[model samples]
Target: MEKTKYSLGYRNSYVLQQYRCLLSIFTGFIILLFISNTAFALATNPGAVCSNGFSQGSLTNADYTNLVSAVNTNNYVNILGNAGGSIPLQVKMTTVESSTNTVKSNFGVITTAGTSAINIQRTFPNISAYTDIIFDFRNALTSQPIYLTNVALSAFDIDYANSNGNTFDDFVEITGVTQAGSTISGTLQPITGSNIVFGQPPQGLQGLFTRTASDPNCTAKNLGTQCQGSVQFSQPVASVKVRYTNTGYLNSATNQEIDLRVDNYCYVPQYIFTGTVFDDNGGITAAQANATNDDITSSGSIYTNKPNYFNGVFNSPQESGISGSTVKLVNCANTATTYATQIVNTGSPIGQYQFSVPIATFNNNTNICLIEEYSGTAYPIRTTSDNKNTGFTTTTYLYSNNDFGRVIAANAALVLKKAQYINNCPNTLNYTDPSLNTANNGDPKTGFSTGSISNMTPGQCIAYRITATNRANIGINNFVMKDILQKQGVNGATVTSVLTNPPLSTTDYTISENPAIGVNGEIKTKSLTLTSRSKRDFYFNTKYGTTVDTQ
Candidate 1:
């Protein structure tokens, strides 16, 4: 008998093992770039702070100095320099030279790539067929330098055509493209393209791209089994518009364009993972975050007062990490926003990330952050028997569920509640009524800040309380609640007694007083069962500053 062995790989987050397979992708502009992408990575910074460009290389002190300067000035520059510059670098060339049978002007084989940096802006088409849409420049490769910025794509035109009825006016967008020698860089986007031909039902050709080798439906067509290939745009795109500028040169003698190619690739769309911010203070709303062209351009920086950190790993079919790796955030339903970063911590979980969100602009001071590790690209739209060039469709989209792999930042989810206390004032001779629950004391909405000054008196009973609420639908097992009272002001209060409004019972839950502290001074945790949507309140008493000195 022969021995057999097998190996497996994971494509989500929160596991120790998967961190070993580090990938590098580098898409020019756009979050969710991956390994292959890093092959042509380039960063460009415009400000004096931070270096203007970077790739698979080291950062100079100048880069750090610039980055630090930008941070200090509240001016967050790209630092990556992958973003666009002063103007849109433009070029005008055709995918192919005009042949005798095909009239150059009428056929619309291609528009002379625009010459001079035309500030002409084009809208991004909404194509939901494929997530990793690659901008394929098939048969358009040349030796001339290719430069692009602010690529604009239109919607698919099924029945529409240019001056000639032969050429369909389908929109194809490949934004933020750059070329260095044989290396190509930019965003691979899925635009409404000329996939559909005339005399064809709109719905008929929509699913044509889905017949790829990766598609289970494509395993067999008619009666035989045939696996085809397809393309996808990497990661969840922040914008379809390209971000950069450059000058393009054409073939000298022919003056024809050079270094032109539209070849890209896409995957089944499982390149991202998620982690929560414990209590994130996100400001963008879901409607606004998810809306098309509805970008929220708020002033202020993203890294101020952000004390939260989250950790997770990413998995891709090939590799991912360079540009376009973004994490989407939602404050439950209150606000949503996206922060794009390069994939760090490829080799270890120790490289956990920190997302600094300013507390001032944070909506819903408390929030749940959604994390997704995105890595993808877009490729040619095709209807072929082999996996090569099988443009994908929505009907055949593959879905994977990774709910358990969610991530949350450290030092998040701090909760505090108030407990009523009957009180009297210090120096009763001239004391006024004990104003409880006042702005000076504690507001019901914002919780307690400063304790009641009038209520401060020796031997007066004060209740320090805590309220726990279970938000999940399912019951929690072995719920542990631990808290250490803070040292208030100069002298502060000291815990004198601990008691439950209703004493704890073993039948349902348990509570311990003065739980033992570990060698590291960490307090022991309390364990109990908490029912779904249930609430519990605990009360204890404390003595105010006993030693008073002249102020």
Candidate 2:
């Protein structure tokens, strides 16, 4: 029972607080884990990152051969070289001695090594796989200097073996040099060799080489002269075709062989995405934009007049209420025939406008326009009489349900109907027609335009309230409906008096004539229950511009 006191040290308290914080964090993390497990899962799509089939990198000579094999049956590669120029330019592992390999001094590899006997060397890392191969070279002798002539490229399965067994058969000889040189080098090295073994003479490995007898300095012979032996090493190739000159050379003074190398090649697919364009006109059926030789081509509709954006499709004002409108997706650039055509129906909903058009149709250079067919002669007419109406002269009148009030009621209904779209949905949306406003001279008119809302969400409670007042005069019976003649033209022209019926909803608020412009000149205030049905009808009217305006 003695007084016992316990003192907590500052250091101990700090440590204890840290431990408590850690424990609380650990508990919170565990709770978070449980919540996450219950939630939806999301991961990046694999195709979104890597969609190509082959890994991208430079291929070796052997690897290149494999690629050629892969694409052999398909003819995927496009070769660019002379008629006999495109042979495998890969290094041969076997060594060639001076005796086994023939070398002409004037035509052979004038190696910087400068040895009497040149041993052809085959470098390692031999193969360079490519879609195809190209070959380009220059002669060792010419009247002016060294230049290429009678250029041709040949493709074969073997890199070093020539049809004649002597690689010289693959030689594309040039005949316009005056040098007294001898010996031709026929070394086939992928990294660096000149000799290409093109088999067989009838196989047409050698393109014709010519020379003019007039030029004394041009002593180069057609077959041999300074013709360096061909170098034939091969990398794997998807294709082996020769791109050669069928015409003249320096001797002809009109053409000359090109100096080049099978520097690089590529193998790419034809098309990436496929889809179509839909006919979204007010009435007609839609068509698709499809792929044509790696490109998107579309055949569809044309805009004869201004376009109308109703719901999701592009419609025409002229064809808005017209039945059996025709539409198709066509390539605007092509003077070609249309692909598909469909009949469009009048008053069709937005979502039902187009069918079967793929998403890729939007990517093409297709133009979407509305071709409207004129339906009727009696079009909408405009008027100029301050279209608003007023009751007879009276000082203080009880306000009756008039055209203006009815218009306001209609608007209120629309507010309810479009509430969901304004609050939650982001994309453009449309609604059906609402019941006509019957109050006084008010006529229901439908319209389409962008809309927005505030203080509500889709599936939430909505209400409509209206208040009407006469600021100038009061104390008389101001009715809501009236049949008054209005001149819709200049001056007091022709007048058409029409009686307006009240709106459909009986649920409404009416404020009798009041003494107050209340606060801010507001004479009366009416509040009505805005039910879900009212909202739907109201939104419908808004789309068609039928909703009337009130006070």
Candidate 3:
């Protein structure tokens, strides 16, 4: 019996251990699954993945063959249809070394002869849309060559209409290069004393280039040596030029030429929208005041309290930008379909905001709108500019100065008055005293008189009237008014009932007891639109007490 019990106990313990192990494994798997899903969600988000819209050149074997044929026939060919075919690659072999330079089909590679200087030009259909150009190059020749000298890359924009007026003065140079997971660093120096122009007549600007022999990738003369680098332009350029002034062999007797192969060309396209949110505190003009009638008081007097409020104009120098405001880019037709959103910058150049969208996100002529949300704490009593909600069609690559303005609204005018009934209350029966009028002298049974009353007995009843008025031209919304009853004498005064003169509409206003202050306080709230420049009166009656009360 003891041996059987021990065996059963051991089996139960083993089962429990297995169950715990399975639970731990299942829990780990669930955690991993959640982590992977979160990462995928972030990666697929448009705002996270499409900032610059970098795309590589994807060319097929047929495309490469066509590129080679076009280069041989016309010395130029437009490859790769990327960015909705807006940016096409046009490669031209301007000065080719006939003896050794060969444009091959493999990866559409260009192998150049090192005997004489070579010039290659790459043009784009829309240069302005591209921000950076990247490509890979290598020296495939086995024999070492005298370091490539005066190796320059230039970028410039050309005007086809004016044959003699091309702009080549803009600086375009190789910014950085990467080789074997390392950076080849060098400083860009001006290519002076060289009369070499990139394209045809009318060169717009001179190009800049850099050279460094200390980098192994550039100095290596081994076969299959490679280096990846990028070219950046100070301004948009129509074409880029790669020139190798001297490619002489290291051993003059060998007659072995340096084979330079260039491939893997890519470009990053950037479409940015920039704007500012500013306070247009230009102030209200005399014409505006006359039209809106906001400068007049209730008593027929000229109201000049706020001279600089709303002027319906933007003053750039005098007025400053409003920071910490949210701005959104949405479809004009359906604003709920938001494309991007940004907050107004709070640092230097305050109130500036920018949004960058992916390539082909919005085609030309697409209706879009930039909406700025108002901040009550930042700009209290202010109204947005007329064009704040305006929409415009997408047309340009760089949209700038699409500003939103805010101006102070008209002055707020409010008035409040309280009055007590002075005359005696009417009584048909249960009269406290005979001095009171039985026919209701000044006070009516339905309403109370707007006069102060004094020297009344403890048992005498009295009524109070409160009036509120909004004199502003603009309507107010959700306006709340609170009245707290005070304790008088020993037993204190108790409010019997409350009433409004015009009868409060359920849609326009609401009346309720203040829960925070108990039943002693009453609150009235008014909605917007129905009561513009309106007045309201509230009446409540209370009986005088004889005993003393603390509160």
Candidate 4:
């Protein structure tokens, strides 16, 4: 009994151990899955930092020294030479690495140079769209790699303004540096002060060195032993001024100077524009529809209502996006000169488009316009919000949501009706006037009816009452009606002259008379503007020539 109990206890213990091992494996799988999903999600959320690295290729220390002298003489110099016109570079220092060093090319070095602290300022184009600036840094003393203690690096946005003055009030500081190619592990400290020195003649800077230095693994023997690691700005900056200070090591007599070497500088540029195009078919209020211009401006809200069969402003979901449309970016003052063109997106989030221009392209342009070309079957345009200002003086960089709107055309129709009347006259020997038994006074108010008439005699007076009606829901402009007063038969009466009276005071219209090719009378109504479901009546009296008999 004791042996059986022992075997059962051992087997239970073994099963319990297996369960724990399985649980450990399952937990690790869950952790890996979570990590992978997070990475996948972040793939679409791109970092704002630009990927292009600024290399100080083949530049010697003498070259940088000469450049600094020139900058001091001229107050500023361009480090990029002539890439983006004339951006100012205040001062810089350079150190060439070994030819085989893959991690760094030529490094921008900042040293004490007989001072306990040093401030280095560098200027470039706008970097407002970026969130961080990353670069590699290392420590050395008189061109020899040596790990230094109590070192701190602080960055300031020189161009940024605060309530105190033009300089940024706060700055980001980095300490506790590690070797290069390794993850930067340090304590980030914030410093606050006034009148931060950033330009030439660096002096009187304020900051504390709290970072502990780690010995770097040296690889480049020709450039001396050095440890390196990267540092990233905690906040977005523009026209930066970096200050390096050390309190642990100070031996100017022995030429044991502490220098901070920096390379692989990067920041994002603001030169992209994005927007979407959609069809405008959602209904609007009667007041909005009747307004002179129904287009919604950029400052206006998105209109939302029932779908209108005729025309309306743009509404999302109710009116879908128009895919495959052509959008072009052109000069606002001169549309003939096109800068960029793209087709509206056809995939998910349809009708979206984007434009990415180079810094030089953006710098050269001032006022720009985004225009969507009309397609063969496209509806009429309803709204536009595509113009933008990209001047050098303007601070706005990244543009988005410059949308357009369009709607279907309105239905329209017109109808016309004509009638004639005869003059009152007694019957002659061989001819009888049609007005013998009828009350034909040649007065339009009493004699003219809304139908045709026959059995007319020569030298009789006739009148015509023509009516035109608009049968659409919209107004019609430039409505014209014409009539020739001679018939084709041999017995047909020929009109000699047409007399017209003033149109009714309720109606607005005009009349004109002219001779036909072979007839003596032709009457036409001047261009008339008609409202929706409106009608107008035109009247004229014609005197017939004595050339035919009664029929």
Which stretches in model 4 have alpha-carbon errors above 4 Å? Answer: 1-268, 283-313, 376-393, 409-551
188-228 per-residue lDDT for model 2 (tens digits): 22211212232323324343221221212211121111222
* Cα lDDT over the full model 3: 0.40
Task: Report the C-alpha displacement of residue 507, candidate 1, in angstroms.
Answer: 8.1
How far out, in Å, is residue 486 in model 2? 4.7
TM-score of each: 0.25, 0.21, 0.34, 0.32
lDDT of 2: 0.23
* Overall lDDT per candidate, in order of appearance: 0.26, 0.23, 0.40, 0.40
Worst 10 residues of 3 by lDDT: 247-256
Candidate 2 vs. true structure, TM-score:
0.21
Candidate 4 clashing pairs, residues 3+ apart or interchain: 176-211, 179-228, 180-228, 180-229
- Per-residue lDDT of 159-210 in model 3, one digit per residue for the tens? 1111232211112323333322333322222223222222211222222311
Instruction: Compose the digit string of candidate 4's lDDT tens values, residues 157-194.
Output: 22122232222212222322233423333322222221
Candidate 1 lDDT tens digits, 246-324: 1111111111110111122111111122221111212222222221221112234222222221111222211122222
Residue 240 in model 1: lDDT: 26
